[model samples]
Target: MQVPYLLDVLVSVLLLLGLFFLLTGTFGLLRLRDVYARMHATSKSTTFGVAGVVLASLLYLRYLGLSSGLKESLIVLFLFLTAPVGAHMIARAAYRAGVSLWQGGVVDDFKKWLDENR
Candidate 1:
């Protein structure tokens, strides 16, 4: 079966987009000063990156008439559902464990909230 030209272009674009986000996330992980900031960058970028890649896969698979893209759809759904929540949980745990923010960090809403509640 001949794949459509537009579909091919779209898949290529999505693949590139996904790769770009993944690289950005990697840079963020390496360059960010603190755990919270690094976690924020990695979680957001990785989720979008993986989503883009999976979406491209789904489109290509659908074009090839394979499995109706159900597996890819579920992967995207699971990523969107878990990434942020997982990041938040990690950040909360780090904060509770007394991980200090970067020196130049100014705002600490979590600290304020903790102080007020206590």
Candidate 2:
């Protein structure tokens, strides 16, 4: 009984962390200014949040003594593989759309490089 319950508890903790990252991502999207910042919020935090949730799902299935955890594990695999591509596309679009950074922001290496190349 205790062993089963402990696994449930672990799953719950992971789920909570997942939710925290999700909420954080949403909050960052709303609170931050500019397209670049919004992409930053949406891309990184949500990816990690989903990762946490997927890990929790795997544990939850394992705790249930299911015959396989492969399905749940696959969800995490899909997330890891796709999240970065989505972020890159978003960032690229924002750049082309001329979204500028906040005033006095340092490090315009990207712009500098583009200028030099063109």
Candidate 3:
């Protein structure tokens, strides 16, 4: 079965973009100096990366006239729903446990909000 050139190219691009985000998230996890920053990098980038891969799979399956895109769509949906909530909870826990922000970072809007609300 011969795939169309455009479909092949789109799949390749999406896969590469997904790989790039995944690698960037990994690098940030290893290199970031603070828990919040690390969480930000991992949650956001990895979710997008996974979504990109899922989207590519959905596209390829649709191109092949398959009805399996629903699974991929659900995967993307679940990832999008969970990643942010998980990150927020982790950050909140870290903050309550007294994790320090990076020394070089400026501005703590959340802290200010907390202080104001308190």
lDDT of 1 by residue, 1-118 (tens): 8999999999999999999999999999999999988997799999999999999999998989886998999999999999889999999899889999999898888789889999
Instruction: Locate the minimum summed-lDDT window of 10 residues in model 2.
Output: 59-68
Question: How many residue pairs clash in all the candidates, one count each?
Answer: 0, 0, 0
Using Cα atoms with residue i matched to residue i, what is each candidate's TM-score against the true structure? 0.92, 0.83, 0.86
On residues 43-67, what C-alpha lDDT tens digit does candidate 3 reach at each position? 9999989988888989998888886
List, residue by residue over 52-106, the lDDT tens digit for candidate 2. Answer: 8888887766766763788877877888898889888888988888988877576
Q: Is candidate 2 or candidate 3 better by TM-score?
A: 3
Give the lDDT ranking, best first. 1, 3, 2
Better of 1 and 2 by TM-score: 1
RMSD per prediction, one decimal?
1.4, 2.3, 2.1
C-alpha positional error of residue 33 in candidate 2 after TM-score superposition, expressed in Å: 1.0
Give me candidate 1's TM-score against the actual structure: 0.92
Question: Best TM-score goes to which candidate?
Answer: 1
Query: In model 2, which residue pairs have backbone atoms overlapping below 3 Å?
Result: none
Task: Please identify which of the two predictions, 2 or 3, would achieve the higher lDDT against the true structure.
Answer: 3
Candidate 3 clashes between residue pairs 3 or more apart in a chain or in different chains: none
> What is the RMSD of candidate 3?
2.1
